[model samples]
Target: MKSTVEHLSPTRVRINVEVPFDELKPDFDRAYKKIAQQVRIPGFRPGKAPARILEARIGRAPVLDEVVNAAIPAKYQEAVVASDDVTPIGRPEIEVTEIADHERLTFTAEVDVRPEFELPELEGLTVEVDETEIGEDEVTEQLDQLRARFGTLAGVERAAQKGDYVQIDLSAAVDGTAIEEATTTGFSYEVGQGGLIDGIDEALEGMSADEEKTFTSTLVAGEYADREAEVTVKVTTVKERHLPDADDEFAQLASEFDTLDELTESLRERIGQSKRMEQAGQARDRLLEKLVEGTEVPLPESVVQAEVDSRAHDAVHAFDHDEDKFAEFLATQDKTREQFDAETREEAEKNVRYRLVLDALADREEISVGDQELTERILFQAQQYGMAPEQFVQQIQQAGQLGVIYQDVRRSKALIQAVRAATVTLPGGEVVDLSDLLGDDDADETVEEVPGEVVAESAEDVDGDAADDADTAEDKADAKA
Candidate 1:
């Protein structure tokens, strides 16, 4: 067998392959066995007919097609691996150019390969992120919410206010188009929860029982229409919060803390930790956005397609091939499968651009993943997946997904290095504290987000990589961790 590659472009190649008569023998024999099983010959058992006899019955073209089709993928894969080029993401379009049943086989496949790009700028670019300092008021507010969680609900004799829980039968119409028909009977929604329909919560803020009011509000756009809907909300009941007594006994009942003061102190610590984490999130997002903007690079089609395939594969895998999630996802959006596919492709394109930009920065600055850092990051991520570290490491090695792993490590290290080189400023014009951007207290919540499909290790997902490592030695460390 001989294979020669013709360069179509930096990211495209046409590999002209020639399989000689000797190499075609194995495939010819195998193809006969496969075809023999599918058809019956007179005076012969199925799959037991001689190759020559079956070929005489079926003619040579059909048998040759079977052999070529069956053997092309394996042959192409070998040729691809042997080539001195970067990896290919999507499957190739295979076509048989020439073939002879016992002579030679030839074909071509047009594939999408990773693009070539120069490193982008990633120096002292700046971004403004919200602060992490937990003011006394913020601490108190968190403490109050915690206290309220343990408190009992009670009926209020007064008018409904902001902090009250109301049970109401709500209905709405849009030029006689009823959309708010969705029932929430005995629905327990927190009044100030902004996640509910916009402006609907404010309408019930001060209303009393049995009071009905018709107000027009626009539906949240995008999936929901932007048109206005006139809603008639009737407040059936309004109940106020009855907080627990902020005393020693109550504190003991609510937590392991001995006294109300101890509980408050613990809450303060937790709240501070939470605030630090929140700021860390903002800091990370700001940093990523800045990194993307700082660098200017064009993304390749493979990069985007690779991400799209990854997402689709994960979604199907997560459902264990149930297929209902795919249907439901599209149905909810009032879209078909084609539209969803396009959306995935678009998302993949953004992901590719972001990844390329970050990588260019890493390369330009000579930043790289250390061996020790890689091992630790892998082990930590394995634990997150609830697997043993050794097992996870073995799996990563087996699947050849280590390139993806190394890229993640390089990006993270590069970002951290940039942070060290940068000078940050806060909104009040004071020099912002850079501490929160690097580390936070809730080490567990810092699970990483890798595009919309893969999750890598970061502050949010510090242990995410461990999840990928699900094998034996890995499982042991994972169990211990």
Candidate 2:
């Protein structure tokens, strides 16, 4: 067996391979064994028929066809492995070039390969991040959030207002035809939360208990999705939350602190810490944008197209792949199909660019993700999806997404290394050291005290948040993979 690679472009390669008949003994044996089980012979039991006898019964063409099909993939992989510099990013397009009866088989494969590029000097690459600012108002807002968590809901004998929670019965109709699925009774919703049906919040405000209002709203789902309909809502009850006073007794009840002053001070410190962490996230984002924009990486067209195709598949997947329905959905967002496509292409290009740049950096720097970091990232993703670690692993495995996770972990670690090497400037022109936020050399204490539910979300949430464009492709590609 022999192989040679042709450099078609900076990011692609064509490999020519020739496998002599003697080298295909194993593949031929497997193919014959498989064919023998499917054919009947006078003297031989199933899967025990000799290869010659089976070929005589089924024709040599069928046997050769099976052998070629089975051998091409493994041979292509071998050719790739033999070419030390070739690293394929996607599946190869294999074409069988020739077959000499029982002498040799020849084939060619074209694939997208990672481009060889030089990494920019990591040290001294400067980027600006938002200044960390924790004002008294911000601290007070945190305190209010904490108090709201402990607040009690009480019945209010007045028209509903913003911040009030209400239980309501809702029904909708299109052209006077009632839609049963859109009707719900006793649904509890906050007046200004704004995640429910459109126009619902506006219709709910100023409505007293037992009072009803009929308004127009666009249906977001079901058969009438993206269609306008008239919705009638009746308020069953309105409740206003009564927050505890921000006093010493309340502080003792709500927190580990002993007094209100202590609690306020803790809130201020927590808020300041969160602000700094947010700055770290901004720094990561700015750094990534800078790396992607500043570097002139030659992206593989196939990779970018794969991303674009995956995104397009997902965009219309909700509409059952019906282009007309997707167009309708886009129309509801005031977006033309052309506009959506343009935006998707731009995002896909950025994603491919980011992945290529980071991968190159990772190689040049010999960056590697530790077992602990990989597991932590997996756990964080599972938590994000509300799945247990084992379940998430199984799901990604079934979807062939585990490799994407591995790549994400690697890219994130590589970016962190770059962050540490780069100079991050704050708004006031002070150089911010991200050593603590990005963690120490061993990275055992990478976790920072980010306020509120952010900590529970993920210790590295800030690091990955700013790279969402790249990370989103990883997530979506898992489905495509």
Candidate 3:
């Protein structure tokens, strides 16, 4: 195979490849033989047909096509690997020209190439991270939430009131047209949570058992495009919260802690974990912002158009059949569909560039996600999505999206290395702490800090109130379904 590379731009290339008749003859012979073994000539034994006869029986074009299809992929892969350019993530536009028994097989493939650029000095890269602090009120508030989680629902003797949970039968319509999707049976809602079909809460503010009420609400056509549905609500049961006593016994029953003191410390640790996650997210965003600022490449119109169409197609499908909110969304942003495509095209280019950078950075730093890291990352994602880790793994495999998950793991590893490899400088002259960004299984390294006057023990004494309350409320609310 003979190939010639043409640089269209720093970020694009055209590789024209030709298989001389001499090179293609062997492939043609193998393909012919393979076809001969399966075909029976009228007077010949199976697998004994000659190439000329087989070519005659099946036309030169069909045999040439088979040879070309089997040959292009291997040759394209070799040509890509042989060049300094990074192979594209998407398809290459391939056009075949020459196809004959004794003639060369000529084809041209246009592909996007990773832009060659200098790495901006990224050492000592720093950004201001909000100081980690556990305040007394925050700790107390957290404890109260935990207590709410442990709270039990008690039967109410009075009519349904605001903040009360009520079992309800619901029905809704649009312009007096009754719709089945607008109805539910035995739905329980906590007044003021803002989840119900509009105006249901206001109508149910003071209603006894089986009291019917009707209200009007403008459906925002947000996620559900049933516009301005008139809904009827009926209150069936009124229930009030009966919280557990916040004593040592309560602490002991709710958690591993036997005392309020232990429970408070645990809550503080949980809060710290949450704060660490936020800080890590901010750091990653900052790194991305910087990377975008430093990279330069000429993006092809085709790549951007493809990405925008893909994004728009997905957005349009999210709504009811033939109905799309993206048009409105684009309008709100002051962009025409064409303008939106142009903007998203730039975003697509950035994503492609970032991916290329990740590939290069990973190779240069030898960054890798090991089996343990993959397992932990998958489990962490499952936990984040409120899915069982093993089940989530199976689901990803079943859906054939595991490659997406693997790429996520690889990206995480690459992000860490890229940040560590760069020079970070804080705008406020204070260094950001990246201790939270390091993997848990990584060797322990003492972070630079004077222990910061020691975290106030008084603040850490707050109970696990907040988390408990959220869990409790979610449990009660979801149980009604």
Best by lDDT: 2
| Residue-level lDDT tens digits of model 3 in 311-376 | 667766765425446677667778787886676676666665565555445455555556776677
Best model number under TM-score: 2
Reference-based lDDT, each prediction: 0.64, 0.78, 0.64
Per-residue lDDT tens digits for candidate 2, residues 356-422, read 7777776776766677877888888899999999999899776556666666666666677777889
Clash pairs, model 2 backbone: none
Question: How many backbone clashes are present in model 2?
Answer: 0
Model 3 TM-score, all chains together: 0.78
Q: Which stretches of candidate 1 lie over 4 Å from their true place?
A: 116-131, 170-199, 213-232, 245-250, 259-261, 278-298, 302-349, 357-447, 451-481
Residue 188 miss distance in model 1 (angstroms): 4.3
Worst 10 residues of 1 by lDDT: 457-466
TM-score, every prediction: 0.64, 0.89, 0.78
Candidate 2 yields a Cα-based lDDT of 0.78
Model 1, range 131-156, lDDT digits (tens) per residue? 56767787677667778889877777
Q: Show the lowest summed lDDT stretch of 10 residues, model 3.
A: 453-462
